[model samples]
Target: MSRFEKLSHVIWHCQYHIFWVPKYRYRILTGAVANEVYRCIQIYCGRLGCEIVELNVQPDHVHLLVKVPPKRSISEVLGAVKGRTAIRIFKQFSNLRKKPYWGNSFWAKGYCVDTVGMDAEMVRKYVKYQEQLEKQQEQLQF
Candidate 1:
């Protein structure tokens, strides 16, 4: 009935717009490389229990809209995704190793992440309405 996901202990809805780039910003993510990247993302996210709301693999960058669990920090989620994907990608596409990815790292040093949710005005309105409902409930109980 609710959009919230039920875990063993927590019910939550946390989504993130995550973006990252390849090492040296190269446009090598074309053809087979792109396909492999997509597969790697799907496998890793599935294993981590993170759902992919949407995923776009670009030549030099990637855009992922993912629903992560409350128990996992953003850093932890991204780290697992990025780290394991890099390993899998390189192992599958060994030619990429000769291109620019030194130290066996495919992605760049860091990534960009933003939360996806309601705007401030909506949240403020909801909070105000919630308080009013509580007040009405107290009156009914008396």
Candidate 2:
């Protein structure tokens, strides 16, 4: 009946709209790379007990709306997602690691995040809409 989550000590509803780009903002997150990124994020979120409301992986950056529990800091969630995704990306796509320019990193140093208190639906639609727009643009390019 309630969107709030219950912990042993608190009832909370924490959602974040997070965005981050690849190192150097490279446009390499296409095709298999994008798929892998999604898989990695899902797994990491599940492991951390976070709920993903929406996610989109563009060629340069990622858009995620997640419901994180109060016990976890946003930085902690971001670190886990970024760190795990990077390691898996390098392992699965070994060519990326071979590139000297990548310089031992998959994501950049910082990310942008904002809390979603009331406009949750709006943000969710925005994420999905962006993905659709991206697909349409891709079709026109081909």
Candidate 3:
């Protein structure tokens, strides 16, 4: 079932599959760091009134299936998610800065974003599935 946002004059369900990697695509996200990243993302998204349908933090990247309000653009939502999570993760994991690759950033410069259409559940399952696919196989349409 889909839970939509109801504004004064409209009701909408906008879901997106977002994925991003660590700086330089390093596989630094694991153990405590991975858990903290997941927690920070959930907290940040919750603060924005966004629902995280599914989330997976791989060793080198992260994925999230989220439902956001129509009033906010994808960039705005991503900024909130990425920007805030970076701050939280950095603060909680100060040792990350010691690594040359990580430096002053936790996430890379850009991310992948795709809208979900009528079959939202299908997309959620796709996000939840653990098996990694080749880059070409991951090219999905909304």
TM-score of each: 0.89, 0.81, 0.77
> Of the candidates numbered 1 and 2, which has the greater TM-score value?
1
Question: Candidates 1 and 3: which is better by TM-score?
Answer: 1
Q: Kindly give the stretch of ten consecutive residues in candidate 2 with the minimal lDDT sum.
A: 114-123
Worst 10 residues of 3 by lDDT: 133-142
For residue 34, what is the lDDT in candidate 1?
94
RMSD of each: 1.9, 15.5, 12.3
Better of 1 and 3 by lDDT: 1
Question: What digit string (tens of lDDT, one per residue) describes model 3 on residues 73-110?
Answer: 88888888888888887888777777777766778899
**Candidate that beats the other on TM-score, 2 or 3, i.e. the better one:** 2
The most accurate candidate by TM-score is: 1
Q: What is the lDDT of candidate 3?
A: 0.84
List where candidate 3 sits over 4 angstroms from the true fold: 1-3, 119-142
What is the per-residue lDDT of model 1 for residues 26-115, given as tens digits with 9 covering 90 to 100?
A: 897899989989988999888888999999999999999999999888898889888988888888888778864466788998999999
